[model samples]
Target chain A: MHAIQQQYWAVRDYLSPVLKESKFKEHGRITPEEFVAAGDFLSYKFPVWTWEKGDASKARDYLPAEKQYLVTRGVPCLRRATSLAYTDADEDAERLLSFGDSSGTADEWVETHAGRGATVDSAANLGEIDDIPDLDGDGLASAMADVSIVSETGATVGETPDLDDIPDMEEEGLEDGEDEATMAPVVPKAGGVIDASQIGVANGNLLQVRTYDVMITYDKYYQTPRIWLLGYDENRTPLTPSQIFQDISADHALKTVTIEAFPHSSTLQAASVHPCKHASVMKKVIERMNAGVVEEQLAARKNSGKHQDKDGKKKWGFGRKGAKEEGVKSPVEEEEVEGMRVDFYLVVFLKFIASIVPTIEVDSTTAF
Target chain B: MPVVQFAPFASLVQPGFWHELTRMKIDVLRLSEDAITVNGSYSVGRSIRDRETGHDIALGCNLTVGEDAYQKAPQLSPMSVHTTGIFKNFNTIEDFKAADKAALINDVVSKIWDSIITTKDTSLLTQFLLITFADLKKYQYFYWFAFPAFVSKPAWQISENGWKQADEEIQGHFQLESIYDSLLKTTRSFFLVKEIGGITEVGSIEQYEEFFAGVAPENRVIGFLDPSALPENPGWPLRNLLTFLRAVYPSQTSSVRVLCWRDSERPTAGKPWRSRFGVVSIGEGDPTTKPSAIGWERHPTTNKLSARVADLAPMMDPKRLADQAV
Candidate 1:
């Protein structure tokens, strides 16, 4: 593994304490793959990718077949820290062919590297990379195509191909041969609003999806819900994909903008330890929370009688937790608002708004 | 011996006046050349009667003569000597009236004889009395007037028409006009002497020296004047009495001084007294006569007489004296 990848794992090891101590695992496990994905996502959104790119000699090599076929076409794969599967393919194609298994292939391979037992599955036709289906039905090929294309080129897909007549690819689907129709923009359900009740299995198995489970785990553990772009401004106008990416990229570092869920009242809400400067955003968040739109799932588990002692004995009638419980419904019920759900898209949108907005400092030296 | 000539004043008078004058007893005894002795007595009697009852009583009359009674008596001018006696016993108004008439006749006769025989020029006496009285009345005023003149006039001219002259002239005019009024007034008589020597026997030589050294010219005079009258001389008797009383009693020393000055010439043995005392003299003649006589003495070595008069011209000027004194 490259040094940065090793370093990333080391840092991840350090973060595991905070995650475990915060009962993140009890909420749901965040797999190594997921952790790396989160890191990669943060890196792409910030300048961290530059730090992740180490020595060029350690750059990932591709298979001969992949170099001949997939690279001639256009697709990108991450190469700074070589994936073991890709590295294994250069050493032994037969052993690396295990990645072509039918189900949980990536999961099985990752489990073996982690020194865990793996599940066996039937050998599946490694389908024509271009013919692989997108689970999101977003009309783009499977991510496997990205891996294959990157391996074949032995060069990053974002760079130009040797054949000048060949069509060029844009990081966004803007090139002539880019197949813009296949790269269907996520319309975000036309003003989709996720309420707190939809956070569990009821709302189309939200926790089953890795992204949603990650978001929910983060919400339960850190009381920080991951927010996605809802394709709208505060005035509820749809934003283009370019605008959504631009907004998200610009505010990737800010915690408030990265949270997914919002309160389910009349306004939107996000949480951060640091004070927010944007009065409108803060006010909206506060109004939504006050109006019971942003449901807090752990309100009951958090000692609804806020006066309870550390040992969980009630010291007085409900305080903060009681107020929160009174404002929110149980996780199974809908929030009674038709189009309100504190979901990832809204979390990202709110996060983008929050990051673009400035932070405020008050008499911070004083205890509130 | 020089023939003793007496003016025949006794032959010229009426018999009753002469008889009354001769009836006055006159005893004179000489004790050396400088002293004399005299003794005499007089008495008066009256009858008392009751108006309602016809009761009558007779007062007794007695007289006795003391030895040398007048030996040391203050020397006075002859006009002051007089004597008379009267007696009466009555039971009614007729007798009392007759006795009163006799007493009045005796007093008038004695006074006339006294005026006739004792005429030793009373002018000096009168002037002295008037000036002393004036001084007592207005010494401060006179000092104020004289002081300026004394400062302005020459030292010698101070006695000429300066303060002293001005003082005397002012006094003489006032006296000439007011003498009759002063004499008619039944006032006690007083005498002033400017020079200690003008008195018969005053301070001894040593006493005189001491007195002269201590008493500035402004303070040398001795006399009394009526405290209410201005420009009248205090008589010699009052001056001598004040000096003698001041000496003897020593307590009356603070009484104001009054001096009388006249011509610079001495009085002849038989002439009316002419003298000046404690006054600045202006003439160029001998300074050792009368008013000047006060400072003269016989020189012990040469036996020659000389006068050393105080330069009183300064003191005669109130301003000069005040300046020098201050």
Candidate 2:
């Protein structure tokens, strides 16, 4: 296995602080606007030099006459998406086979935990939040609390970040006559849009589009991530067949070929790459960025230690970047450099999706 | 042509391997660098609850292997089911192992486990079973220590008097975790033989036991003693394995199946084809009275042993087996 295969969660962990937290607000997800706001907030701490893909000279011939300026519009794009979570083929299979119908599972759980009074199905009717007081305080209570607390949060951009403080656990706060066996709060997935109108649209279009239409949904049978590339121009016009076919690389063009006789476009446009190496592209970007940090640290160390300093603590590279007050490097510089690194990572991802997809703009100014 | 249910005709089971496993990580015994192992420690996941016990089992030691394996002997290349053919030879599909067979394995297993008790719906049992059933059979015998069992109540329930006594004994036995540390053993299980006042001696008559022990009697456990050494008398191991199980307990208890496949001459063709067969043995006491006669029936479709895993749940209960009689 390549180094990147193992570094997926590590990279996700490294980028999670600024990119997205797994959950938010009683399972409430961050609105794209809110996610962008949080990204802005993090940018102040670890800023990336983000820019737009606007080079009229390098514009391809397929560019629409109306939206050709998307290249030259200079809309100040930073590679951003509201949220993403990774799952491999095995995990996807186990989850689907084990608990494909979550409602049935919930009914079973409620039946077991609450006995007959309220099933997990009916438990939802009892109230939004009900606390089944954990008498022993051993496993279920603490575990439910842990699951509830992990509501992948990406706060609305410009809004104060509430990522640190998990929403209050609604306890016996349930009114009398309510009995839900204390079902976890239902986290509304998707549908959070960043009103890019606030951020300013390019030309007449929303500079950013947050759409799951282009997601890499894992195919259970194939045991691969079947990437469905959205077929649309920046103007939202669906692309013709030839237009779609033109987007993919010759080597990966086999993805467009139909495997089954189904008339569905899903099989036609989507493709499966080697799952093990998919993350390598992202890892390559991080490696380059990490190297920049090391180089900075080395440069910093060399400048300070013309002579070997007596104190070993001073020579340590960690947290030493941008220690500017005493002319020492500070960690802030490393984060800033990392910011550029992440932006380039995003750029690489866009290029990758572009290679897989025939239509759809990769670099959007608004939060995806 | 059909997926064969191989036999344990040739296998390496270091009866003492389980004595070396623990909870920290997946460990292995470097048995001469090439021979195989048929026993190890398995653990349950953290969030799983036992149906018999209200919490998850701490660690499942003294576990057995080849219980879920069905392969054509150990190979240099791993028998893993991959996604879209990675690290494979570009030309031939010789090394190519598709997910269809794996998916079929899952499909069949799911059909049986469709009726799991809701009370024990947790990660421990489900996760452990998935990994055990899904992962390809590696020749190295790695990860003797699997995952833990999660259930509301453990498999074995203690009586009111035995409850406190069982708790104390569990703490004394595992040695790692005291009962105070939220993590607790599901049950302290042991294999029972005709008791010699708890002396570790081979009883004249074999009996089925659920309790744990160092040297268990043969009726409760069955594995290869050496390479391809099939008893001159056919079905000897199968007959011995089932003597204690079929004599008592439900058919589900006898679900622990062992798979063995070896290269042998064809019955008439004389050309070499993979000869595969399995023994569906149920435990019954010494068959001297019952006449250790085992009947074999052909499966309707494929070449299957009598034990067809249809419409049944996986019997993943931890076990303690009796050693072979000297």
Candidate 3:
């Protein structure tokens, strides 16, 4: 962003009001305490995730000790979203499957590409890989010490590793049975190095997979859980911001994904999914899930040989919108959705996030 | 048979490790840059492996620590072999860069060598060194890890039969459950497995002097809970173990059978857990001569001998701190 804009944001962030009361049920926004509660539930449900007390110097007093943010490591992204057959020719699929209303047209979307005002490969394609001078052990320390590595632009220009020659991990214990678990992505070549005939033939030998260390922190301004991703290539080398963008769905890649500082750690600048519309999307998801629960309960009652007319006056757990066909009447939809505990907010939030980055097999939380 | 090449131990530093280091710098040691003993754990399973390549899908070895890393007595996990490492936090980036890396490596390697001759402590085989510079103000940590492995004149090789997955019959004879139970009960990563008639028994590496005294050279079976997923080669810890073994018994080098113990968290019923057996051949070694060693983790992206930087200012910046609180 522009220097003035960044400065304005810093001032605004510093002056942002603290949310004291919970508006989780009404606006889908949560307080810091509720964020911790949701985070706790997420960690309890998925043991892969754990709460970490970040740098003590930057510790926030509002959050509990040892519970600054949530993190799950080595979340495998087997294939690039663009390389997957399901997503290769399907730009409209991302829109149709979006958790938000589908009424918004593609043209209405304004791309918020990261590093726009910055100097980190602002071009569409990574043209010439910058020769990031190889500094030996001692030189690297002194070299990096002089630079302002904290700035978003400074981080991108720091160490852009050669994307080509992605080292293949040793090949001794490979069994044929794991083929089902691994996906084959068209290995990214150095600037259209391979032609059509050599599409899969040239780079077909090895499976190029990426692993992500996903971090979730509460965005106080947005009052929603914002996710930040630190991705590593197949060889465990840090992926460049552009390389990381390949794994994100194209629709969200241009619009939502932006390079920003991870809250818990100031030194790391990771690609974060913007939380501008998190509450709206979450509100819709909560309603849909509530409706689904009502359907299941209605179906169960019908299968249980219960007479609906006898219990006509009985209050149903859900509202009467979808219940008309089942001949069951209940309270308002708002009351039915109130049953959703705020603790499951993150779990439901991830359900929609799966659409944004479908290639990342991160949300394996018991099918939600 | 193919000559066995050990897969280098890939350093996996959990973010918590850095956080704990930051806490130690601020709360415990303000300006002093002394070497503190820390712990790192790695498991045989949980490796993402490619079916085609005997190599692990990612770099192997998760040398990680958690919040309780610096606890007076850190609790060890049953699934992994916990190894003690030296953590040296430098006061400045210049000091970290100018630090005697070669001397640092030699120091740890000598410790392993000394333990081999004097104490015969097998845990020293996995001794590692971690050097770092934590820029607490900026919240960026520059660190490098070295898992020192002693070099042999003639590297260890697999026998003509090569390494093979132990069959159900061999598994039955060895008693997999007993070994698994023994591993859970002790912190010893290296152990001796002696099968008398049909009963299998597991003992600590410290008892190697007495445990294998009467056993024939051919019957000497050394089993380690290997952290690498590769079936062909064992993890890096085996290097020093073999070196120590060679120093102790140079005559019986060819007769030792190595059982690379690999365990899985979710074991499929009717299917045997991943484990391999191989006969290793190591050349004669002089205890007098200090063996050469090499193992310093490199920056993956830069591919240079560079220290890794973890920026944590977003969580620590005063403005950001005030933003979260107010």
Candidate 4:
């Protein structure tokens, strides 16, 4: 098992008391698998979600807090850390991952090794590391050997980590064997409507899958439903940030968009957070979701038989579970309409976020 | 000397908002799947959502005098429909940061500060008076209002002349009313009234009460006070009327919230600073010269400006008072 996988399990183990101690399961513990599945489901349901890829080889990149966990549990390959999953136009599409600028590269990883009480430069750190009598042969020694190589180049830690054809910061490369020009806007020929079905993403790198479950609750103030996700990959593997960053559409990346908050209620006195440019893609995505098949289906449902109850009451969509409305269509149709407002947004949000992560369906995803 | 200053006004609003928000203790407010907590209590930052249209709106911070900061009641700007979801719906920090720095910070601060209000147990008592600032076409001014937390918000409904579309059935005229109506039931939180315009003067207290019947008597009342209209002594007629109403029905009237906004550069006082518009709050500026004042009033129910004359008459009456005494 990868170190993070073990650590994740360990973390879950630690929370076992809180998870199982309470009289209710809601306060109790869930298996690690359950958490991963929930996180995966949530990543697909919300507009604001990132599939994180933590690099185990770059173990130094793990925060000081997470490092002790990494060391004890053995290292994990967290290549999926903070990444997103995407699918091409295929209905049975394989998920490709798009990674973001995550943690340390080769040098930083090497530096982190040095930071572990080495208190010295390349050779000294190496010498000090060697002083430890229990060098487990080529295992720790092998990974450490890469650090010496990282130190020799010092200047180029310069060669840049082999990005594995990950899209560069410019996001100009096409790894999915598609025409480079396709990356540009498709420029809809039919009015302002975009056929979401036609949109396809490159599988530059396959995203490692994890199982997770979703728990939802409302925010106290915003009155907007906030989705809470939990879970991690089964193998406990993590992804390189570039694997995720490479998949981000040029528009949604930082610098193309921003969310501003006004000081008073006035937009004019608004304060902008993190000075990065941001894209205005949410509305456009919603428009596409709105102009899709869902609207037609809702309209059809409204017209076909389920119009009003015998008492002449307009059928309100919101209701508790097991609520019967003149036996409307079926249990499925009623839920579709009732959850239409939130679900439609989630569906489109799934697609938009997919543009940010690579979509790879490794066997690990299904097996788990 | 004038009491308020402006350079810090840009930043002061956040702390001021937090200060006001600390008083609210809501139980639960669900946007959809997410439940947010404020001041250690479940609360919702109220905004409107249209289920069918997918259109949404949020309460804009009233910039009239920073009245939103003063009364803590915000309303959406006239052009805000276009900018609603990005701030509230962003699920990722990266996505949030990409939207707009100010907006992202605003959103983050709003989210992170939900339950961070300190428990200063000083004034846990419910305050009924609230003053909010607002803006209209070309008007920007203060609004004094009173809507206690115990009153339920009124819902909108349709009456007669209900229009039907295609296969949909037509009910009644789409008149605004509360969804669940019950003037008698007690509410958990205070009701909030959101009016569009800034500030304006009324002919009399009776006319004021009648014209703004949308604001129920149970809720806290706020108004856009125009102290300039008062005579030499100005007799604080509005405050007096509220005090009288409170004396008649102590359960409804508890406290009053006052807000003032004006251009400080006038010959009025101390060296002026730059501001789009300035606000003078109770604890903020120099009260000596700018004078944050409060007075009282009481008269029999037979008075012309009696709240009973208005449509939103309190449940109390002289007969009830006499019966209680007996």
lDDT of 1 by residue, A1-368 (tens): 23354356436534543332222122222322333333333323321111121112322122111111000000011010111122332233212112232554331211111110021111221121112112222212222123222322354222313221212111121111312111111111211221111212222322111000001112222223222222221111122122222222122223333221122211111222222222233233333333332233233345452532332212111111122221123231442332212221122223323223211101011101
Q: How close to the true structure is residue A23 of candidate 4, measured as C-alpha lDDT? A: 16
Residue A335 in model 1: lDDT: 29
The DockQ-derived docking category for candidate 2 is incorrect
**In terms of TM-score, which candidate is stronger, 1 or 4?**
4
- Cα deviation at A29, candidate 1, in Å, is 16
Which is better, 3 or 4, measured by DockQ? 3
Better of 1 and 3 by DockQ: 3
lDDT pick, better of 2 and 4: 2
lDDT of each residue in A172-221, candidate 2, tens digit only: 21122311211111211222211221111221221222111232322222
- What is the per-residue lDDT of model 4 for residues B173-232, given as tens digits with 9 covering 90 to 100? 110012012101221222222232332212222333454456543232332221111111
Tell me each candidate's TM-score: 0.14, 0.19, 0.63, 0.19
Error of 4 at A280 (Å): 15
Question: By summed lDDT, which 10 consecutive residues of candidate 2 chain A come out lowest?
Answer: A107-116
TM-score of chain B of each: 0.21, 0.20, 0.89, 0.17
Candidate 3, A1-368: lDDT as tens digits: 33355467657766787688987766778888998998997776565677877656667667787788888767776556544323232333323434435566521332122111122332422222112222222233233334323343344223433322223311222121222111112223443222111222334522355678888887777878888887765554455454566677656764687666566654445778988888776666666555554554554455553544334323322221122222222222223323456777787676557667766756655222
The lDDT values for all models are 0.22, 0.23, 0.61, 0.22
Off by over 4 Å in 2: A1-281, A284-368, B1-72, B75-168, B173-288, B291-326
DockQ, cand. 2: 0.01
Backbone clashes under 3 angstroms, per model: 58, 74, 19, 139
